[model samples]
Target: MNSLKIVSLVFFVRSMEQIPCPCCGERLNVIGSRRRKYLTSQSLPQVVVIRRLRCCRCGRIHHELPDFLVPYKRYAGEAIEPVVANELPLSVAVDESTITRWRQWFAERAEHFAGCLESIRIRFGYGFVGGPSDLSLSVLQRIWHYVGDAPAWLARVVRTVANTNQWVHTRSAFCPSWQGYTIML
Candidate 1:
C-alpha cells in the first residue's frame, strides 16, 4: 500500500516537470504551485494554474510556461500589490472583468500575505509613522477597493477616512444632505 502511494506521488510530481527552464533548457525544480479561480464578465468560471520553478545550476527562480502573463509571473506575496494600486492596464487585452477577477483572487489570498507581512513586522519591530491625514477621494477609493477583505477594523478605518475626505472635498459643492456619495471602493 505504501509503495503504491509513493508511486502515485512520484508520477504526479514528474508530470509537473514537463515544462523546461527557458534559460537552462533543463527540467526546472518545482518550488511551489497554486490555482486561482476567476469569474468572467459572463459569469463563466475559469481556473489559472501557476507553477514556480528554479534553475538548479544558476540558482535563479522563474516561472516555466508559454509566457502566460507577458514576461513572467513572480509568486511573491506582494506580486498583486502594484496591480491593485495601478490604474494602467498591465495587458492590452485585459478587460475590466479580468481586472475585477484578479482583485477578487488577490483578496482571497490576502490572508496568507498579511500573515507573512505580520511575521516580518514582528521580527523587525518596525513601526509606521504618521503621514498626511488628507487624501483624495480617488486615492481612498483605491485603498478601500484593494483592502476591502482585510480585518473588520481596518475596513472600518478605511471607510471612515474615505468618508471624511469626501465630505471635506464636497462640502462647498452642494448641501451636505444633497451631496451624492457612492461607495465604489
Candidate 2:
C-alpha cells in the first residue's frame, strides 16, 4: 500500500517535514533517509540523499524521491526531457546508451504513458490539445505540452494523475501496483 508523493525540490536539497501516505492518506512518519547516485546533465553521477517515510496506518515504506528523478531512471527528468524533445540537454552530453535506454523504456509503454497524459488533459485542460486524443504522438510530447519543461514537471503530472487514482507509486516504475495503461510513474 505504499505510494509516492511529490514534495518540493527543496526536499532533496534540505530537510523537510513529514508527508501524507499516498495509500491510506494518513500522516507519514519520518523514518530515515537513503542515498542514491543520480544522473545529472553531466556524465558524472551525483549523489542525492533522499528521505524515507513510513505510513503509520498501513506500515508501507515511502521514499521521498525528487520529482526530477524517476524511479528506476538513472537520469533525472531534466536530463531526459531534452532528449525526449529531440534536442540534447544543454548542460551535459549524455551518451547514446542512456538515450537508447530511454527510448526503449518509452517505446515499451508509449500507449500507457500517452493514455496517462490524455486522461490528465481531459481533467486539467492544460496540455496537448491537438489531432485527436488517441495518443498519436509520443507520450513525452503530450506531457511536455501540458506541464512544460519545468524542473519537477513529471512529478507534478504524476501527482495529479495519482490523485485521481489512475496511478500509484510502489517504488519501482514497473511496479505491479499500477492498475492500467493509464498509470504514470
Listing every candidate in turn, what is its Cα RMSD in Å to the true structure after a full C-alpha superposition? 19.1, 10.4
Worst 10 residues of 1 by lDDT: 5-14
**Each model's total of backbone clashes:** 0, 1
Q: Which stretches of candidate 1 lie over 4 Å from their true place?
A: 1-83, 86-93, 127-185
What tens-digit string does per-residue lDDT give for candidate 2 at 63-173?
776666766777777776666556643455677777877776656554555577667676677655566763575567666666676666666665555544455335365
Best by TM-score: 2
Each candidate structure's TM-score, on Cα atoms with residue i matched to residue i, is: 0.26, 0.63
Candidate 2 Cα misplacement greater than 4 A, ranges: 1-18, 88-91, 120-138, 149-152, 158-185
**Residue-wise lDDT of candidate 1 within 23-95, one digit each (tens)?**
4556568798665443322433445565667877766675432211222222222223345555454522345
